[model samples]
Target chain A: MNTTSILDIKNLHAGVAGKAILKGISLTIGPGEVHAVMGPNGSGKSTLAAVLAGREGYDITAGEARYLGQDLLELDPEERARAGLFLAFQYPVEIPGVNSTYFLKSALNEQRKHRGLPELDAIEFLKLVKEKIKLLDLNEDLLKRAVNVGFSGGEKKRNEIFQMAVLDPTLAVLDETDSGLDIDALRVVSEGVNKLKAPGKAQLVITHYQRLLNHIVPDYVHVLMEGRIVRSGGKELALELEERGYDWISRELQLAA
Target chain B: MSAVAPATVRPVEPATEVDPWVQPFARLESGALFPQQPAWVFPLRKAGLARFAELGLPTLAHEDWRFTNVAPLKGLPFAPTLAAPTQRLADGELDARPFARLPGDRLVFLDGHFVPGLSRVGTASGGGVVTSLAAAFRTHAGLLERHLTRYAHGSANPFTALNDAYFTDGALIHVPAGRVIEHPVQLVFVASGEEEGRAQHVRNLILAEAGSQFTVVEHYLGRGTATTVTNAVTEVVAADQVVMDHLKFQDESRAAYHFAAVHADLGRASQVNLHSFALGSRVSRHNIHTALNGEGLECVLNGLYLTDGDQLADHYMVVEHAQPHTASHEYFNGILEGRSRGVFHGRILVRPGAQKTDAKQTNKNLLLSDDATVNTKPQLEIYADDVKCTHGATVGQLPPEQIFYLRSRGLPLETARRMLIHAFAGEIIDRVRCAPLREELDRLVWDRLEQDTQIQVGPHA
Candidate 1:
C-alpha cells in the first residue's frame, strides 16, 4: 500500500549504555492510524518510544528510521521536534524557574520560524494557550507558574498532552501516559489524545495496560515480549491479552524459540 | 601525574606598588565646608582619615579582596573630584534616566555637590526631614550629633572612613516617632562626565524613631565615559517598633567605578529591609552590614547583580545578632555572562546572649559562558545554644533538562537558553516591593541580556 507513511522503522536494534534492549523490532505507522505497543515489564516499550524520539544514550546499532522520507536517525532531538515528532514522556520532567507560557511561546515560535511563518505575538499566543488549556481540563493558574513544578501526577500527564496539542506534531508517541492516571484522569487524557488525531497525522500509543486502550481505541495492537513482537493482530488481541495476561505471549515466544 | 609542577621549585612574583587610587583620597579633608557646623565634625573627619590611613587599600593578599584586584585603577589617571564649580549638567540629561520621575521628594547631587534647582526638597506628610547633608549638618546638628558619625565610627570598612573624611555633600532623612511617610524619599547621586578619573565621596544617613515607618531609595546613575568613581556610605538607625525599606539602585557607566557601604542598627522589635541592585560599572563592591541590637527584630538583605564584558561585581554582608529572638535572612543572586566575574560573601554571627536566633543566607549564580566565574561563600557563627541557621551557595548554568524541554517544544537553542536565564533572574527581580520599580528593572535587565547575547553570538564571534 503506497499511502503516505508517517513513520517507518526497519529492523530496529537499540541499546542503552552498551546493554542491548530493543532487539530486532520493526513497525510501520501510516497517516490517520493509531498503533498501541503493549507489553509486560522490561519488554522495551519505552525504549522504543525514546529511540524513535532521538533521545541520547540509546545507541541504535543496526537499523533505519525515516520520517516524512527524511533520515530521522540523523536529526537532533530539537530538529526532530521541529519536524513534527512528539513524545509524551511517562514521567514528565519538572523544570523549575521556567514559566509554562514562556516555554510554550518559544517552542511555537521556533517551529514557526522553521516553516518561514511569522511568530505569534503575546496577545495571540495567550489566546491560543487559554483555549488549549481547557482541552486537558487543566487550571489556567498553572500557565502562570513554573512548568510542572508542583503539579499532581495527573496534572503533569495532562500537561504533556497540552504541550502536544500546542505543538501539533505529525507523529506522536505516547509512552505510558496512562501509568499514573485514575478512571477520570484516564478518560480526560484519552479524550485529549483523540482530539489531536487527524487524517494526516498518526500516533503510537505505548502502554502496559489495556484500560487506556479502552478509552482511546486503537486500530492495531502489538504484543512485545522479551525484545520482540511475538503477536500482532486487530483490536481483539488487546481484549485477549486483557483477559489472559502477558503469560500467553511469553509462553508462545518460548515455544517459538 | 607530575606533568610540570611536581619536580620544580616554583617562582613567586614580586609585590607591586600600591595603586595610586588608594591613599591620597583617604588623607584629603573637607572640613572647611562644615565650618559653621558642629565642633565634632572635624575630629570625625580627622579620625576617619587616620582610620583609612591605617587600613589602606585592600589587596589580593586579604581574603576579603582576593577575587577583586584594584590593579586596573593604576592604569587610569586618578584624581579626586573637587567642589570646584564645574559646569552643571542640564536637567534634561537627568530626566532621561529609566527612573526619572519617582513622584516624591528628591535630593539631587551632581558631581558630589548638591544642586538646589533640581531638588524638590521637603518633608513627607509625617514631618520628616529630607535635606542635604551640608545643610542638615547646620540646621539639625543635634540630631546629626546623636546618630551621625555614630555608625560611621563603628564601621570597619576603609571606604566608610574615606567617605567621612572627604565627602562634600549627600542626603539626610529623618522620620520622627509615631509617624509614617507615605512616599519614598529619593536620593539621586549623578556623576558628571566632565573629567576622566574623577572621584566623589557621598555620605547619607537615615533615622526612624519609635513607631515610625518610611521608605528610601538611593538611586545612583552615572553618565559620561570619563571613568568616574563614586564612594558612598549610608548609615541607618531603625528604632523600636519601626519598619523601613532601603533600596539602593546602582547603574553606573561602563567605564566608572563604585564602592558603597550601608550600616544599619536595629532597635527593639524593629524591622528593616535592605535591597541592593548592581547592574553597571567596570568594577563595583558593596559592603552591607546590619546589626540586630534588640529582641525580636527582623533584618532582610536582598541583592541582585548582572555583569558582562569583563566586569567584576562583589557583595559582602555581615548580619550580627546581639540580643535574643532575632531573625536575619540574606538572598543574593548573580548572572554573569561573557568573561565577567561575581563574588558574594555572607556571614551571620549570633552573640553569646542572643538565644533563639534564626538566620538564613543563600547565594546563587548562573554563568552563561565558559569563561564566566563566580565565588560565593556563606558562613555562620553562633555562640548561642538555641539557634537555627542555614546557608547555601550554588553555581550552575541553565539546566540541561530545562533547555531540552524547551527545545522539544520546537524552540531554538539560543531562545530556550535565554528564556531559562531570564526566568532564573526573575525569581529575584519579582521580589522588589514597588511594582513600577520592579517593572523598570525588569525591562532594563532584559534588554541588556538580549543585546549582550546577540553580540556574543555574532557571525564573526
Candidate 2:
C-alpha cells in the first residue's frame, strides 16, 4: 500500500462478464500529480474507469486497487464517492424529472453527511451551486431543468465539470470528457478542470486525442494498448503521440516481444 | 360473521348461472329509494337497470376486461347503502385527509349519502352552484335532469351502469356562463369502517356553460381495513368555449374494491383537463372517456397510480374525435411493487370525415420487483385520411445505468431508487396546473414512497 499516493493499482486484471479487458495493469499516482492515460479505441481505457467507480458487470478477477491506503475495490460506488473518489462518466446520463440543482445538492449533502459535516439547506445549496456553475460557464436555467435532459453534447460535458467543481473530490477521474465538445466548449471545460486543481488533489485524465491536454496539461503521460500501459513518459509524450499515431508503440511492443 | 352463509363455505355455482346480485337488486328496487325525485329520473333508473342486467358482471370472456379479473367481486356479499346512514363523523376526522386544509366549499359524504352537518356549502363568487346532488334535485332540477345520467349512463361498463341504477347522493356543481369559481369545490367521500362489506354508489354531475371555468376534486378516503366497495360515476358537460378541470383522487382502504368512471362531453373551443390519482384498494379500476364533439376543442387526460402488496390498479381511457381540428392527449404512468399489478388500456378513435384531428397517448410503468406485473395496450383507430395519431407504451424496471449514475454521485442505493421512482410519478403530478395541489401531492407522494417497505431498492432482475 502506498500511503502517500491517491490511487495505486497493482497487477489489476478485470473484465466484463467473462472476457478480460485490463490485464496486469499497474499504476500509482501521488497527491498533486496530474496523470493522463492515452489509448486508442478498444484499449480498455473505460474498463479501468468503470472498475474504479464500482460499476456493475465488471469482474476484477485478480489483483487489487488501493486508494488512500484503503481497498478501493471493496467499497461500493457510493462509498467510494463519499471517500472523495469521483468519476466523470464518458456519457452523461439523462435523468428525466430530476432537477439538476436538486440532484447535485443531494449528492453534495450525502458526501457531507458521510464526512460528519452539516448538510446545507436549500438556500445555502443554491448559493454554492451558483458560484460553481459560473466556473464552468453553465446556464442558470439548466439548473431548473431535469438532470442532463435536453442538454446539448457540449452542455453535458460542461455540466460534468461543473458537478466535479461542486463535489470537490480528492481524486477526480475524467473519462473521455472532451469527446464531443466544440473548440470553444473544449477550452471552457478544460479551463474549468484546470481551475479545480489543488495541491492536495490528484487527477487521472483518460483521452484519445491530445487536443484537451493542450489546455489542461498533465505531468505524466502513459500509453495504454491491449489492456496494458506499454510506455510512460513526461508531458511531451502526448505531443509525440499526436505527431506519430499509436501504431509505432504497438510495433515497438511486438518487436520487443 | 352474520347468520348468512359465508361465501367460502357455500358450494361453487355454475358459470352459466345468474349472478347472485339479482336478489339484492330486486330487494333494493322493491324498497322505496328516493320517491321525492322527479318523474324523469324513474325512466333513467329503469334504463340503467336494464342496461346493467343486459351487461351483467364482466367476465374473462369480455375483451375490455381481459387483463383485469373481477371474479373476486362476485363471491363477496356487499349490501348497498340505499339510504342515509346514522353514522356520526367528527370534524377532526375530516381534517386528517389530504387537501383538507384547502380553503374551498367542501361537501362531505359518508357511505355515499351527503352529510350536511359535516359540510360547508359556501356561496360561489360568480353565481355558480356548489351543493349536494340531493339538494340540487330541488334547486337546480333542470340542470341535473339534463346532465345527470345523460353522459355516463350509456357507458358499456357495468360498474357505471350500477352507479346510475342505485346512486343515492353525490356532488352537483354548475358554473354558469362566463362565471369562474375561484376555489375548487372538493367532494370528500369518507368510508367509515363501522360496517364491513358495505357498498356505496356515487354519482357526480358537473355542468360548465359557455365561457365558464371551474375545477372540481373528488377525493375518496377509507378508515381502517374495511372491505368496502365504491362504485362512482361522474358526468361532465362542457359547453362552447368553456374551460374546466376535474381531478379524481382515490386512496381507499387496502381491503376495499373501487370502481369509477369519468365521462366528458367537450364542446366547441373548450379545454378540459382530467387528472386521476389512485393509490389504494385491493382492486381498483377507473375509466375516462372524452368526446370532442365540436371543432377546435382540446382535452388532456393525465393519471398516476401507485400499487403495492396484492393491490391492482387499472385505467381505461377512450378519446373520440368527432369533429375536425380537435385534439386529445392522454398520459398515464404507474409504479408497482410486491405482487401488485397495473393495467392500462388506451383507445383513440377518429370518426369518419374528422380531418385534422390530433391524438397522442403514452403509458409508462415501472416495476420494483420481479413479481410486479403490468399490462399496457394502445389501440388507435383512424378513419380520417388527414389525421395525426400516435401512441406508445413501455414497461420495465429502473434503468441500471441511471441508478449507477446516481450512486456514483454518492447517493445511497435506496435514495437513488426512491428518487427515480418519485421522478417517474412526478412527470404526471407536475402536469397539475393547480400549484397548491401539486405541491401537496409532491409531499404526500414522497412520504408514501418513503414509508412503503415493499419497494425494495436492490436489483430485481
Candidate 3:
C-alpha cells in the first residue's frame, strides 16, 4: 500500500516502424489515482498505452518510464505484466485453443510468483475467477471456451477487464475499451474497473469520448493531439472537450505551435 | 506371380523359425475365409490377397512409404492366431483400465478373434446395435457387402490390401435410422499370448443409417507379453442426414508394430468427426481417407501423436470433396522427443463441379530434441474455381515464450515443460467428442510421454 507515484513517464517519444506516434509525452500516475486520456483518432493515446505495456514494434526513441522506481522500458512485455503492469487491449488477440480460465490462471500465478507469493492451484484459482467473473457479469461458459474465440466485441472487452481484475496489476491501462461496447456494457465494464481500484493500484483510462470518462470518473483528464499531450486539466476538461469537440483542440495546438 | 523371388530380399539374418505364410509373394489361406461371402466380395477378397502377395510388404523404396521402412517386418514370423480368447469379460481387468467407465457398448477382440464373453453388447439407451462382424456378415450381409471395402479399396495401398485379405474378426456397429446413441461404442483390440511375431488383422465396419447419430471409439492395446503386429482397417458410412463421431486410440505396447487404415464416406448433409491418438508402437502408420460424396456433407479429422526413442509414427490423410457444398477440415499436431520421428502427409482434393467446397488443413510438429525429426506436407488440389481451400504445416520445438511463461509461475522446469507439451498435444485430443475416450487417451498419452525417459528398448522401438 505504497502512496508514491507508481508510474512516471517523462518526455516519452515512441513510435511504430519508422514513424513517431508519441512525441515528448509526460505523465505521472500516483497510487490510487485514475488518469483519463481523451483524444481524437491518431492522437498517440494507444501508443502511450502500448509503450507502457512494452509491446514490440514500438521504438521508444527517447524517454524514461519508471514503475515503482524501476526502469519499465528495460522489461519485456510479459515481464512488465509480471511487474504489475496490465494493458487492456482495444482489440484483444484471439488465441484459439487456449482456455480463458487456464490462461488467466497462469497469468495471475506468474504475477504472484514475481511478487514472491504462493501460486494458487486449479480449485483455488477457479474460485477466485468465479468471483471476479461474476463482478464483470460474464458467463461462466466463456471460461471454458477458447480465449476470446467467437466472443462478441463487448464480451472481449469485458473479458479483458476481468483478466485485469484477476491479475490485480498496479498500473492498468484501458486502451479504447469503450469503442465496441454499448452504453450498458460500457457502464458494466467501467464499474468493474472502479470496483477493482484500491489505494495500491492505479489506472490509465484511454478513450475517444467523454462518455466513458463520465462513468469511470477520472481524477485527471489529458488531451492528446498529434502524438503529444496538448492540454491537461481536472475532470471538467473532459466535459469541455465533449462540448467543444477535438477539432478546436487540434486547431488550438496548431495555433500555439 | 510365382512368388516374385522374394522381391530381391534376403531372409532376415539369424531369423527365427518363419511361418510359410511369411514368405514374400506367397498366397496363403486365399479364398478360404470368404466361402459364404457374396459372389462379388469373394473375388474382391481374392483379388486383394493376390495384389497383396504380388506387392509383398511395402519397403522404404515404395513411394508412399519412402520414409517408413518395413525392415522390422523381415524379422517377424507373422502367423495368424486362430485360437479364440479364453479370458472372460469380468476377468479381463478392463475395470482397472483407462476408458473403462465409458458409457456405451464394449466389444473386445483378443488375438484377432472376437471374444463374446468379454464383450458388453447393448445400446447406451437400449436402442442401438453392436455385434460382431462375423455375425453381421451372416445377418446383415447385404449391408456389409455393400459398404465394406467400398471406401478403402485394396488396390490403392498394399497394407490396406493385406488388411482386407487377412482380417478375421472386428466389431460391426449399426445405428438404426433416426436413432441417436447417447454413448460411444468402444471396440478394444488386444494382443495377448506368448506367441512371438504373431499378426492380428482386424476389420470393422460401422454404418449410421439415414438420420441416425452415434460415436465409436476403437482402442488397440498390447499385453506386452510378446511381440505382435496389428493391421487394422475400419470403414464408416454415414447416410443422408446422419452423424458419426469416431475416435481411434492406439496405446499398443512398445513391442508392437501397428498399422491402421480408416475410410469414411458421408452422404447428403451428413457429418463425421474423427480423431486419432497415437502414443504407442515401435512404428505406427495411420491412413485416413474421407470422402464427402454428397452435397452439404462435412468431415473433420484431427490427430495427435507423441513419440520418443526410435519410435516412428506417420499419419496420412486424404479428404475428397466429390460434391458441392461439402467441407473438410484436418488438423494434426505431434510432439517428438529423443530420436523419435514423425511424419504427416495430408491432401484435400475438390473435384470438378464441387464449387462450394471448403477445406482447411494444418499439421504442426513440436520437436523436443535435436535428434528428433518431423516431415510434414499438406497438399490441396482444387478443380473448382469458387472453392475455398487452405493448407499449412509447421515443425519446431515448443515456443520459448510459452515455456518461460509457465516456468515464471513457479512451476518446476520439468513440470512446466511437460505441461506445455501436454497442452500442445491436448489441442488435438480435446477435439475428441467422446469425453471418456478423450480423457483416457489424454492420460495414456501423458503416461507414454513420461515413460520415454525410463523405457528405451522395445521391439517396436
Best by TM-score: 2
How many angstroms is residue B25 displaced in model 3 relative to the true structure, after the best TM-score fit? 9.5
In the range A15-97, model 3's lDDT, one tens digit per residue, is 88889889898889999999999999888887888788765568889988999988899986667777888888887766556
Give the per-prediction TM-score of chain B: 0.90, 0.93, 0.88
Clashing pairs in 2: none
Q: How much lDDT does candidate 2 score?
A: 0.87
Better of 1 and 2 by DockQ: 2
Cα lDDT listed for each candidate: 0.82, 0.87, 0.79
Candidate 2 has an interface RMSD (Å) of 0.4
- Per-candidate clash tally: 0, 0, 1
Candidate 2 docks with a DockQ of 0.86
Candidate 3: segments with Cα more than 4 A from true spot: A1-30, A34-91, A105-144, A152-158, A173-196, A204-257, B1-45, B82-90, B123-129, B135-150, B193-196, B225-227, B368-371, B384-386, B396-427, B435-461
Ranking by DockQ: 2, 1, 3
lDDT of 2 by residue, B1-461 (tens): 01212112111233233255544566555546776677787667767766676777877666677678888776777678887887778768778679988877889999999988778876554567788888788888887876788788568887787787778899988788998877778999988756777889989988888998878899998885768899999989999999877989999999889999999999999999999999989989999999899999999999999988999999989899999999999999998888999998888889998999999989999987789999888887789999999888888888999999999999998888878998999999998877777888888878888777433754452
Ranking by lDDT: 2, 1, 3
lDDT of 1: 0.82
Interface RMSD of 1: 1.6
